[model samples]
Target: MAGKGVFEEIIDGDVYKYYADGEWKKSASGKSVPIINPTTRKTQYKVQACTQEEVNKVMEAAKAAQKSWARTPLWKRAELLHKAAAILKDHRASIAECLVKEIAKPAKDAVTEVVRSGDLVSYTAEEGVRILGEGKFLVSDSFPGNERTKYCLSSKIPLGVVLAIPPFNYPVNLAVSKIAPALIAGNSLVLKPPTQGAVSALHMIYCFHLAGFPKGLISCVTGKGSEIGDFLTMHPGVNCISFTGGDTGIAISKKAGMIPLQMELGGKDACIVLEDADLDLTAANIVKGGFSYSGQRCTAVKVVLVMESVADALVDKVKAKVAKLTVGSPEEDCDITPVVTESSANFIEGLVMDAKEKGATFCQEYRREGNLIWPLLLDHVRPDMRIAWEEPFGPVLPVMRINSVEEGIHHCNASNFGLQGCVFTRDINKALMISDAMETGTVQINSAPARGPDHFPFQGLKDSGIGSQGITNSINMMTKIKSTVINLPSPSYTMG
Candidate 1:
């Protein structure tokens, strides 16, 4: 088991070093970036900010380590991954504590995130071992002119090195989601965790380190994306990329030519409520989905489209639920905590103001305490309002009333993002109809939009993402199928 030494070092405010060549090394640049606590607006700690030259060194090291790491048997890789998962589970409390301070995640949710990450790692390992390479016999006799003499065998092989960039909203879970699959699939990894949540991610990476992965197989580089983002993505050493962020993903896509890319951009997930829907179920899901983690998730319910006939009743129920949500610092385990940064709060506030000016009605007085913006629920939001289309990524939910189910589906499809959406209704046929009609990747029948308790085939249709992501899907993306064809001897016609 990994000791808590590294976690203690980070919590004690020691300047943390980036992990490269399988060891923690001080940045050659001698510069560092502060990790801010959103709740207190204080520097929780600082991590080394590597220079471009340092990034180059880490990439070269990873590239050099790839062949040996890839040559390791799948069973051996799975064993290490299982060990890392156990270590992560053992350190859940310490990592969750760091998560609470670094990103303002509620204590309970932070703990859950760590545990879930462990499960993800474990699942990836188990799945990796079970994945079998395919083989098939190809016969030439089907063409009627040629004899059968060919055999084809296909096997999964790793893409050299995967560059994983995780968003601040889910640093541990998303980072591990990328790391576990890439490693289990026989590829080396370079993790560029979000600057805001780097410390927590570093702690997770330390578990892999303690699991005895080969030198340089896994590396962590911490720096401003502006400084190293382009260089890292465009670097020749990176064979593939698995990224989770917003506009940064767009920028990376343009620069990451030829390299296989798996990205999860932000989304404006919508929840549609039909007249026949149960108001209690709809409202409860809305509050839980929209307000949890202060609505920092990419799948958070950004907009609600409800039938105008039932909108009033649904709004009343939602408002009552929102009012009961406790608001305070994450240390207090409140339902609403400060967002990741003040700029995020500013961006969210701007969207709220735009909706208000366009005739949206607020259920509560607008409040802002630094990064902590008390949860706000808005009703009567029109299509013209920026909040209807924009992703606030904060503790605000907007309701837009519509005349029919078609209108709700149209509103969801018109958005540039098609990550996920949901429709609430009692009619099973109606739910399935809307589910098929919605342009988003996944649609919920009567529940608020969510990622999962199970790793289903999660994806986005358009600007939401570039590819699918789940335990199995990610492993497939990280590896390529290689086929070997053999020319067999043909039987003599005269012998028979």
Candidate 2:
């Protein structure tokens, strides 16, 4: 069992080397990137930032590991994944603490991320067997003459070395989500976690090492995306790239050339409230989806579209609920915490101020203390407003009034992003109608648009992203389908 002390050591700042070939090593260039604790706005540690040359070395190691990993028995790989999950379970508390210290994640949310990540590991281990590419018989049914003459075989083939890049918002969960499936699909992984959330990820790498994976099977490269992002993604060794970030995912996809790219990008998710919505329930759900984690999640509710008949009432409930949310240090168990960086805080503030200057009314007073911003609800916000379209990624919810459900759907669809959205109503028919019409990937009838179980298809439509992320989907994404056809001698029938 991994001890609490093991997890604590991850945050102590002494272990700053990048993990490669089952060992930690400093960058050959001897350069490092400073990691800041979001809660205090202070530099907590510096991690080795692998240079392009170091990336080349890591890719070579990963490529060599990929061949054997792909040949390993499925059950054997699954067993190791389950073992990693057990290690994570033992150090759950310590892992959550690291997240709080590293990214200023609210304690409860941080723990949930860690536990869910472990769940993802377990879920992938089990589901990988079921989803593993199996030989499928292909028959020539349409051509009766060739019925028994042709048959096709299909199998899921591993895509060699995978370069997985995770976002800052979900350092552990999303990072592990990528690693578990990549490994289960028999692909070696080279993970690049952003500096904002490197500690939790490095700790996760530690857990992976404890799981007894072979050397060169997994590596962690920490650094600024600009410095080594292209160097890693465009390398010839990487067969596929699984990325979750905003504009960076797009940039990588273009440079990745013909390689398979699975990306889950940004979102401007909205929550629509019809005239018949239950105000109390809707308000609570809205606050949870919008403000939790300081609105850092890709699926967080960035805008609210409500019917004019019930807009004012819902806004009141939202204001009351937002007012009660405590904004403090991550350790304080606040309902809200600091954004990842000062620039993020400033961006949110600037959006709110821009909305106000354009006549958007604030429902409650907002407080900006350094990197943290208390919840702010804006009323009378127009769809044309930047807040309505941009991904603020802060604790700000913009409420826009709509005349009808059609108008609401139209407004939601007009945005460049189509990640996730939800509609609140009791009418089953109406719910189905809105859900089908909405352009986002997933729609919630009476709930917020958030990623749920590890088995469900968690993906974004349109500009939100190109590929999906779930146990089954990720396995398919990480593996390639190969079909083989063998022509057999045609059977001859003798007349008796």
Candidate 3:
């Protein structure tokens, strides 16, 4: 692995302290957590784990900051966000390098993610000024001749504090997706970056500060979520939460009382192939969607549901494509890289072995080295197998045969997760029918189920998530509607 070269360059002497009240400081309890570089499997940095006292201080600062940030003219806030986007663009290379070192994201994918985050920042900035609530004219006919009218107005107002918890997979993009919207919508933020990917997040926040955002308007508190997540969520000062992770979302909803939550949780997405589908194209997309970023994306296609008529042929095509994928350092040009941790590799390997024990045959050789598990394609994977239902979060794909499109849809909907799914066919009617019938948040007819543009609605269903998250939708999610009505008196009228 190319050691942390540019990663060390960016964070040279950068403070890893807990940021609050527009300043960085150590934890009141003097506690810290070691940040590991997944690629090198070495401890590269230490971030302070905020204690309860620091959590309170950060929330208090957020509450205070929200009052003024919310009062700032919407256009001014939008301008600041645009400035932040430009600053991020200037540091794009460094941020991408940090992602590769911090979370083991591939170099190309990391750079793309940085660009995506910048787009999100710019999108939210433009949306904040354009998507304002409009006024409505109301007429009352309570007494026929005695008429009265009222002018009503509605607009989105900031919710005081938003606690944004972003996952490790997309350290820069996901965190910025949340932070940019919250700030543009005039809400103060307390971002809790994934401990494993804090360095990239710190670099991102510093850009926001340099962009001239108001002090205390945004804070990034580094700590174990189990410790400070609940404390901050349950705090009286915090008004909303935007979390992107696993089952922790349910707990956050329960513990946070009645605050609004925008969460995008785990996904067990599926890629369904029909008999008439293009096998080579499907294979190519499956390999791209499944093995990219080592399958760490929430929308990664973990299972391939193929009709029995084309199962064998499709598996062969996929096997051929898998052979060409390179498994090595993320800094190199490779199809796969080391996953976030050794445990993820073990879990994925266990699932593959379990399928093998249960009569599933591997279409390709299973190669493992340290945290990198080369792409594995399991054919004849039964629905009862864990690999068929679980989110592997690694470079593995389970292929299951189905008799009909209905059977494939049934299998796809049977899981507790319903984040996203894809179907392949040339017939538009069948595509629409399958898309309408699939029990997921988003359905792709010919494309992989994955995150798209920053302006599109991105979310999940079932246990996958609570609310939508994109530029416009997220700004709406971070704000509350305030309605006002003004009564107007008319000249006296004779009864009809």
| Residue range 1-496, candidate 2, lDDT tens digits | 1223665433324547788888877777766788788878888768877788888888999999989999999999999999999898777787787788888998888888888999999999999987883558776644765655667788898999988888888988889888999999999999999888887788788888899999999999988778887888888998988898898777777788888878889898889898888999899999999998889999999899999999888888888888799989999899888898999898889898889889999888878989989888999998668898999999998999989888999988998899899989989899989989989989987888788787889888877888888888999999988888877688433369
Error of 1 at 28 (Å): 1.1
Quote each prediction's TM-score: 0.96, 0.96, 0.94
Best by lDDT: 1
lDDT of 1 by residue, 147-228 (tens): 6666567788999989999999889999998999899888999999999989889899988988999999999999877899
Candidate 3 colliding pairs: none
Q: Candidate 2: worst 10 consecutive residues by lDDT?
A: 1-10
- Top-down TM-score ranking: 1, 2, 3
Give the C-alpha lDDT of model 2: 0.86
Give the least accurate 10-residue stretch of model 3, judged by summed lDDT. Answer: 1-10
**For model 1, what is the C-alpha lDDT against the true structure?**
0.88
- The Cα RMSD in angstroms, rounded to one decimal, for candidate 2 relative to the true structure is 2.3
Q: What lDDT does each candidate get?
A: 0.88, 0.86, 0.83
